[model samples]
Target: MKSSILLLAAAATLSAQIDRIEGERIRPHVKFLSSDLLEGRGVGARGGQLAAEYIAAQFAAAGLKPGGENGTYFQRVPLRSVEVEPGGALTATAGGKSISFKWLDDFVATSHTQEPTGQFDAEAVFVGHGIVAPEYQWDDYKGVDVKGKVVVLFTNEPPSTDANFFKGKALTYYGRWTYKYEEAARQGAVAAIIIHTTPTASYGWQVLRANGRAQPQVRRAAGEPALTLAAWVTTDAGAQLLGLAGRTVEEMLQASDKRGFKAMPLGKIHVAGKFNFKLQDIETVNVAGVVPGSDPKLSSEAVLYSAHWDHLGIGQPVNGDPIYNGAIDNATGCGLLIEMARAWSSMEPKPLRSGWFVAVAAEESGLLGSRYFADHPMLPAAQIAANLNFDSFSPYGRVKDAIMTGADRTSFFALVQSVAERHRLSIKPDGHPESGGYYRSDHYSFARVGIPAFSINMGGEYEGRPSDYAAQKAKEEGSTYHQPSDEYKASWDFSGMEQFARFGLALGIEIGNLEKIPPRVDAK
Candidate 1:
């Protein structure tokens, strides 16, 4: 009874501390970070550098020591951008009928600079989902001759009503667009285009077009063995292409609902596109700072907190707006980090294990900044405790549950849940696990190297709202997610953000003090 009373008192005290995360305090940071002056924090843009400088300033103010290479808070990432523009019309001849697809309206094409000009007159095959998972006995490419041909693939894995099939409603790696592209490359396909639908891809064609229309793909090098072109098309395009096979897109979609599906050929099809690519080398910086551990022995070991600060800069305008503010997408995340650093700096008891705040760059293009850091970390990979990545935090009311994207993949996830539970908040796996949210962020960059990683967002059960209100709100946000409408608004409620800030800070502290290293996957 005495111990229970003590626990209650502790909970009350902790709740009070969490309540200290004032919206007024976090508002200015979000405003400044998401301001138009920053131009969406695009890679290699002036706004991106400004964002880096701003984060470095916040780190300094928080009293964190520089943990970057040498004596600086900046780790320079050698980056490059490739702009693939439509040189001419994108023409496709199929079923003895030739038609052209509009570059921005119907299809988006990306190609390498190695080929100044080229054409691929290859056979077209509809490879459902482009997946070949031996474990699931699912092979979309099995018994198919795709070599030197252009393949058409689906955006996500096949639907499954059975738990045994592709994790049921939960999307796996096989469902990711990246996986589809990789599979195409491995199959010796000249090029591949994944068909997109709002329901399947979780976002509208506007996102795909906005991402590919004017946005330059960030590439590391002028590499070779490249596909003639890697592309994406709207559902209408898929319908037209499949129509040549005397088949309907819906029929193919239904056929791909589960196991035992075969690839079908669209006869006499030749896909060709003219791509104009201008490549340039650029430098972006990842801002990192360290709150050194109080214990000398544990000072060398560090826990990582990361947020990507880059977004799509100036893209094709919508209603005269082109700046991708990325306010909720990441400004909120960076704001949370700043608040966390502030809370930690003034705490009476410092964390036993060191904590590093990393604001990465080129997250929109890829996880470039985190990738570079992982390759060249100040501390050895083995000594790093864990990674907590923040991205696209909602600014609504307090939520009943914390949604962690990658939490389920590692044993350390239990520790995170425990910390939140102590604060009277429940934690759950990502509601949209089908989106491959686990692998989409910076934490995964660290996780790939064997470190336990977590990417957390606040959602599920909003206060003073319906039980499923969070899910509905998520759907509403999906429409404007990557569009120019992603600007910051003063009307946003910060109650949920405050809850997340407190929760994350407490979780970090708990993980920081633990002597046991975060669990790693054991190799047999």
Candidate 2:
């Protein structure tokens, strides 16, 4: 009877502490992280290192244990930067005519390996969308041999424009360019090149170039087999090459839109490039802090709250502003992570499940740091109950509902719904599966290995704003996203951010106190 009374008192105290975590209280952290001094928090840059240290300091101040390497607050993730200098000499021959393409103009290629000045000399074959999903009964390589040859692929999966195709307007993992490259490697192709179109790729050629680099991957000595080269060619360049294969670009695309498409051989094709890449090992960190649980058995289970702190770093100047400060893109998410941790730590008696507050690195480069932790976690994979990720939170205003990016794939909606209702908010279904939000964040790394994961955001039904406020915010955000113009402003609001954080804290507490968590929902 005495123990029961103590438990109730502890719960009450914790509830009061959590209520102290308000949006206005988090303003200082947000302003500092998004400040110009951080230099956009670019991974591998000094600013990135500073950001990691700042997170570590916050963790220490919050009374959380250092959940990192050697009893410290940093998980050192070794990454190699491969800058592929575009002096490439590319040539393709078809219809008895040879065409020389302009480097970085018609296309851009990136390398992740340690090889310098890589060369590609092989036959080129055209494969539709370059996806092979057995579950879907779709195979682009049906009756084709691409081993030791260059395989040409198209971006996106046969256009998931409707529910009839790969989730309909929602992008499956097979639709991403990364998946296209992985599939080519699985097919034993020496080289993989994607044919890019503005509409198909959902961005312009400039978007491709602006984001082109030998995306930093964890420096792995041995892992999955990879293609020798991964390249992208513009639609015009693709048309030139496809024309030589005795098929018009339209004919090939039309054929691609349907299923059971066989690979088309580009007659006597040859692509030559001497890619100059500067490979160097760069060390980064994933800042983690842990709050131990109250119960021994359930304490072994940990629930993760993740947010990426890295952004595009310093890039080409827009309107003479070169730094991509990533104010809303991710800095806000990191601020949320820290403030949430502080509230959790203030509880008199901790919840049953341990809580992991992870601020990962190199998210903009590719979800590398998260992938590293998901593979080599502080605790075993079985101990991680679920993951809730936050990235690019909208600071527009409060909403009547909250969003779950991949809610349909998980049983977690019950808990989220129950908690949201207390705040007079409804649970909103993922409205843009077309954005592939499920496959793009830190939570994905956890979900890939079967840990139930999902991301949260404010729903579009804004209160005290115009009916079209959501649409307006989307349009404005999409316009300046990833550009130098993504700087923070004094006029921006964080009331919605604060309310969302409170909701997330409540959800975390519920999960931490659960006796049996929801079943693991596999994204596949």
Candidate 3:
């Protein structure tokens, strides 16, 4: 009996030692990936490729098999980079008179295809709020066939005073710019331009320019007619365009938000100047590896873990520092990936289901890398069990909580909650759903395709702090989020990271060993 107790004590000590080593293993890799040498891991840059190779090397060292096609760790993603020529102009003609506006100052446009050039010479119609929600009994496209015409759209949903309309102040998927563009395409419209307002868009025109300037990603599919062009006009510019048609922007928006609104033609025609396109063909890669299950029967099933490895890359200097090191935004996430792989690799009996670690690129570019992977997955999407994604780790010391975004939408919540409770941490829903952060990350692409994917994040929220205070802390940290000042600071406390890594590993183990796959919440 005495010898058996000593053996048990020794086993526990060994387990603790392994955990400590796994924690240490992740730190160096995180430091290297986010170092100035990596140049923010920008897509299409050497640094981005370097980051991919680094992840592949770590995956290989973790004893995982290449899960990508052709027996390699990389799945090459074909991307087209189209930059719009500056100084392009849009001219609207009405009443036999015309008005012209310059790009950037008044509007912007780009294609989802690799077309070097395109044009739209169509009539203009105003579509109220541009939303068609059967549940809300609001159909802006009612009785309007906008085929081959330009459709103008208001930015957000209706006001709360109209109870029967769209969720008043709440922004739905219909309010998103992506939805606006898609709805226009579905209506067979030749072009779409969204009217931007500070309140509705949640940012200024400069922010629009900053986001719009980047090369957008579209799933590379053949024979699809990419929309000719899409643009966002400032409220002032929108008003000017409306004035050309003898109408006020305010009156139009008010009419738009009300129930039973109709699509009205502005009776104005616009001709945009020839757009010179700047095209660069580039390839970004997703790094992926697999650890086969020890059970031969269960090896066919796989669990996926993903974290984006790219940030803003090298950009405009902030405080004379040029590298957007992204130490927290994702470097820590990449670190956690490595640590999780190590923990699984060292398991005594290994896991029942195979594990895949995918370090994706271009997440900063709107989940492009993951989008490509989900569209062209190495394993069948159905065969995969679940996906766990990490973006940033809490920089605040240790936390008693693990915040799960999109929690109620899936049964994975229970799994995560169980693990959190075991670790003396609470599971809470994301506080800022209005930001659409759930749809903004890499996991969103997978979730859209019927794969159960979730993103777990650490919080600065303390036990006694109010939700507003916690949100402020998140904002303060996010201010340095995309800036060059994101370099890893020596003052960062790694204790919280240890708990985070352990929690992630435990969650993976539970999922890998589970008999049934977690299902999506029916309500969502």
Candidate lDDT values, in order: 0.79, 0.81, 0.76
Q: What digit string (tens of lDDT, one per residue) describes model 1 on residues 1-524?
A: 99999989866755555566666678888999999999988888999899999999999998998877689999988865666755655667865787677776888766643344546777788898899988788999989999888898788888765668777777877888877877887788888988888888988888888776333344525443457677888999878877766777788888876578998787666776666665667888989988888889997888888899888888888889988888988999999888887777666557788888899888776687888888887678888888889898777778888788777777777787788786667886666767767667888788888888888788677878998786787687656788888878888998778778888887777788788775587210
- Write candidate 2's Cα lDDT for 372-435 as tens digits: 9999898888888888888876777688888777655767877878878977798876776666
Off by over 4 Å in 3: 1-27, 91-108, 155-172, 202-206, 212-216, 219-222, 239-254, 267-273, 314-325, 463-478, 481-485, 518-524
Residue pairs that clash (backbone atoms under 3 angstroms), model 3:
none
List ranges where model 1 is wrong by over 4 Å. Answer: 1-20, 112-118, 161-165, 213-224, 468-478, 522-524
Model 2 pairs in collision: 160-169, 162-168, 163-168
TM-score of each: 0.92, 0.92, 0.84
Q: Identify the runs in model 2 with alpha carbons over 4 angstroms from their true place.
A: 1-15, 96-98, 159-165, 220-224, 244-249, 474-478
lDDT of 3 by residue, 425-510 (tens): 88865654444566778887888787788887886565555656657765776556567767786666676777787877777777
The worst-scoring run of ten residues by lDDT in candidate 3 lies at: 161-170
Better of 1 and 3 by TM-score: 1
By the lDDT metric, which is better: model 1 or model 3? 1
* lDDT sort, best first: 2, 1, 3
